[model samples]
Target: MMRKQTPWLALALLTLAPAALAQKTKVDAPPKKLYCWNENGQRVCSDALPPEAVNYAREEISAKSGLRTGEVNRTLTAEERAQAAAEAAQRALDKAAEDTRRRTDQAMLMSYRTEDDLRRVFNERTAIVDNNVQTARYNVASLREGLISLLQTAGDRELSERPVSAEMTQNIRLRHAELVRQRQLQASFESQRGELDIEIEDILQRYRTMKGSLPADSAPAATTP
Candidate 1:
């Protein structure tokens, strides 16, 4: 019975020996990393990071291999943080503007079959603005003539030692005001016409660019009148 127990004990010892040795080896192994950073312009290294080095740039090095494994960037200053935020905001705005522009270009390409169609629409718009301007100009001229006649009549009354009537005075003031208003309207219409011209030219240039990018079969040919 003693001899049989001895063999069983030896078998158990052999099985447990490797696991014990593995545990001992793991516990005795060197640390994997050392945290290092600059302190007062001097290099400082430690197995554990210090509180003072938390916001500073740091490097991780293998304790056994003595090779740098990784790095941590320093915390940004307030000004740098603000600048980064501004740059991010500007990028977002630029992306939004680019998206809007792309949508507009796509809409323009889908709406107009040819450059002639685009021009025809713009031409009609400008024609309406031109008619408004012409009408305003005619009204202004007519009002100015009426005002001039009233002023001349007042002058004649003063020269003849007769007082100007209140009714005539009121008519002169009303006509002058109407003339100024009509002149302003004429100027506004002219400005609209100019803006339309610029807008149409820009759209035509963009249209040509869009057309040029398409396959030859897909592009519209210029129509001759």
Candidate 2:
């Protein structure tokens, strides 16, 4: 009877030991952390984030998550992209124009130290053009005389009751063509002279403005005709 009672007691202890160990494990386990997802402006929370959270901003702060707070991220819209490109293009244009202005101002200041110096340069440049104009005028005058001489020769032949020789006809035509070329040259020279005049006036006015000779509020200096 005593031996049978010992076997029963050992079996009862083995079953009680398993129950105690299970209870200890349950108490020692860590609590499950909560995760949340933001859908549009709404907050949806659970033990894990929903599949839609992949497209939305996530809120991990447990306290802040209850307030439904999260940051939204997205690509720019079409209109936004176009406006950004336009602004960048405008910036590039402005930078290029500014660079050109700076370079021009530097060159202008370096070329002339005084108003008299500017005038001297202007005169020198115009004098060269003036000489060209003079040469062109002389050439035109000479060609006109040659044309007149040819016309006179043709008149003489007709007055004497002789046929205008092919050679004389050709000579008159050649002289006329030469006269036309000279006149064209003269016209081009005059046009160039006018351009030089305008360019010189523009430079002078700019130089005066840079030197502070003209009042800042005053209108541009009137160029001499």
Each prediction's total of clashing residue pairs, residues at least 3 apart in sequence or on different chains, is 0, 0
As a TM-score, model 2 comes out at 0.49
Q: Estimated TM-score per prediction?
A: 0.54, 0.49
RMSD of 2: 15.9
lDDT tens readout by residue for model 2, 26-77: 8897544455655667777676656656555555534524554344453466
TM-score of 1: 0.54
Q: Residue 16 of model 2: what lDDT? A: 96
Prediction RMSDs, each to the true structure = 9.8, 15.9
Question: What's the residue-level lDDT of 85 in candidate 1?
Answer: 100
lDDT of model 1, residue 75: 95
lDDT of 1 by residue, 18-77 (tens): 999999999998677999999899999999987878999999999989999999999999
Query: What value of lDDT does candidate 1 attain over all alpha carbons?
Result: 0.89
Task: Name the candidate that leads on lDDT.
Answer: 1
The global C-alpha lDDT for each of the candidates, from Candidate 1 onward, is 0.89, 0.75
Report the poorest 10 consecutive residues by lDDT, candidate 2: 216-225
